[model samples]
Structures are given as structure tokens and as C-alpha cells.
Target: MMNSREIIAKRVAKFFKAGDLVNLGIGMPTIVANYLPAEAKVMLHSENGFIGLGPTPAEGEEEKDVVNAGAAPVTIVPGGACFDSAMSFALIRGGHLAATVLGALEVDEKGNLANWMVPGKMVPGMGGAMDLVAGARKVIIAMEHTTKEGNPKILKSCSLPLTAANEVDYIVTELGVMEITPEGIALRELASGVTLEEIQAKTEANLIIPDKIDIME
Candidate 1:
């Protein structure tokens, strides 16, 4: 059986159609590659300066120089090539990316996203995320339904520092799929064995459940 992380990524992949130029965030979002259709033709872009990346290389088959922005070893597809970071940011800043899958620390009802820093925690800094969110044609978030401490990540408002304001388009977690709409957060789908009651109980935000919700298979 797939774990919750794998399950979330698998569900999120369905939103990435062929021909999309996608940038995958480092953590849970990275697993989406493993779940994409083998026949689908999608271009993977890395903010660190590569496009047309294939997928994570198998163990022992890694190329030390080939890595994504997250520094994870990856394989390049046939047409993939590396460029400098300036060119990479140029693509992102120019809004050339069709879609971007991201991992979130917290997403508020108003679609505000907070992922870069936690108070008193150490991190290098927020990299290209601000540009990615600003420029990507559409943003898709993949993350857990709740934090390890059982705190809801989908909230009425983020308590942490925000990475961006009012940009999140869609959210996919282990328990459900939600869309950020002008009205509020709309619960679009629920994973198998998850209940609307459970989602509402765990979430700190007001979840709008449509009359018809897609039950994830």
C-alpha cells in the first residue's frame, strides 16, 4: 500500500496534463514524478537551471553533476539541457512555466501560502519560490493534511511568515483536494477512507464542501 505522502503525490499528478512545463518543489511534490503517466509527455523544469528533466535516477546510476534545485540527483530527458541560474530565473520570472507543484507549511482560506520559514528555525532562505508562485501559470500544492504534531496545515489564516499572498490555486493533501476560490477554500475531493467530518475537524479553516465531491480512487 502506498504511504500518505505517496498517495498525496499520486492524486496531485492527475492535475498535470501533457505539454505542461512543470517545476516540482523539493519535498512531497517531488514524488509526483514517480506517479506521472509513462506515456504522458511533460517537460520538467528545475529552477537551478535545467529543463526537460526525466526523473530521479536509480541508485548507483546517479550523475554527481545532475541535480534539481533541491539538490536531489535526477536524470535528464532527451531534450533536456542545463543553463545558468540567471536564465533559469528568467524563465520563471517571465512566467514561462505552465504549472508548478509546491509543498506548503501552511495555506490559509484566502489562499495565502506560508512555507519558507518557521519562527526561530534555521533555513538557508527562501530561494526561487517567490518568483515561481508569481510566475507559474497555475500553482498546485501537495502536502500532508496536518503537521506531525497533529496541527492543521490548512487554516483560516497562517500563523507563520508567509511566502506569498493570495496565490495558491489548488491544494492536495493525504486526506483531500481543495481549491482556493474567491469565495473561500472549497473542498473538491476526499481520499478513500477520509470523511468530510474528519477533514473539518482537523482543519482550522472553513471548508466549503460542494454538493458533489469527487471521491478519490
Candidate 2:
């Protein structure tokens, strides 16, 4: 069986198509780069000023100067370009990204996202998340189903401060893939070995289950 993070990343990678200029946010979202289908010609973007970002560098092959927005060493594909922060944010805010995958602390049925910081916790100020969510053509959230304390992250409404209001397009968790539809949060697929009742019990949001639910590969 795939691990929780791998399962989430694998499903999230399926969302991208050829020619996509995608951005992977700091944590779990970055893992999606390693899982992209070999045939899918996607260009990964790093907010720290690199486009055509490649998968995580292999052990012992790390380059000191080449890194992702998270400061982790990463590879750059052929034709990748590097520029300064001004140009990077310009691309983000100018709506050049095809999609952005980000990890969220909480997401509501209305597509509200809250990922930057928790109350009173010391955190680096919200980086490009605010701009990426608002500017990307599509915003996909890659997060665990619940917090470490086992509390649901998908809620009826976010209790944490908002990162972006109603900006999330799709949410992929270990349990399944959900889409923020006009009707509500729609449960589009279920992971292997997961049941509908278990998902419902764990999620605070009332998921709109379709008559036919597809199982995630």
C-alpha cells in the first residue's frame, strides 16, 4: 500500500496535463513533482525565482545554488529559466501560472483556504501563497485528511484566518479527492481501502457524494 503522503501526491499529480506551468508550494505539494506521469510535459515553477523546476535532487547530487522556494535543493529541467524575485512574483501575480498546488491547514466547503499561520504561532510571514492562490488559473490543495491531533482539516467553515477566500479549486487528501462545486464540496473519488462512512465521519464538511464514486488508482 502507498503511504498517506504518496497517495495524496500521486492523485494530485493526475490533475496536471501536458504544457502546464505548475507551482508546488512548500511542503506536501512539492512531492507532486516526483509523481508526475512520465509522458506529462509539465513545467514546474518555484516562487523563489525558477521556472521549469524538476523533481527533488537525488541524494549526493545536490547543488548549493539551485533550490525551490522552500530552500530545499531541486533540479531544473532543460530550458528552465532563473530570474529574480521581482520577475517571479510578476509571473505569479500577472496570472502566468496554469495551476498551483499548495498544502492547507484548513479548507471549507466554500473553497476558503487557511494555510499560512495559526494564532499566536511564530511563522515566517505568508510568502507567495496569497498571490499564488489568487492569481493562478487553478488552485489545488494537497493536504492530509486531518491534523496530527486527528482533527478534521476539511470543515464546514474555517476557524483559522483565511489565506484566500473561495479560491481553492480542488482538494486532495489521503482519503479522496474533493472539488469545490457550486453545490458544495463534492467527493469525487475514494482511495483504496477507504470507505465512505469513514470519510464522512472524519470530515466535518457534509460532502456531496455522487451516485457513482470512482476509486483512486
Task: Report how far residue 93 has shifted in candidate 2, in Å.
Answer: 2.1
Across 94-198, the per-residue lDDT of candidate 2 in tens digits comes to: 889999999989999999999888889856678889999999999999999999999999999999888999899999999999999988999999988899999
lDDT of 1 at 50: 90
What is the TM-score (0 to 1) of candidate 2? 0.94
- Compare the candidates by lDDT and give the number of the best one: 2
* C-alpha local distance difference test of each model: 0.87, 0.90
Local lDDT at 134 for model 2: 93
What is the Cα-based lDDT of residue 171 in candidate 2? Answer: 92
Worst 10 residues of 2 by lDDT: 117-126
Colliding pairs, model 2: none
RMSD (Cα, Å) of model 1? 1.5
Clashes, model 1: 0
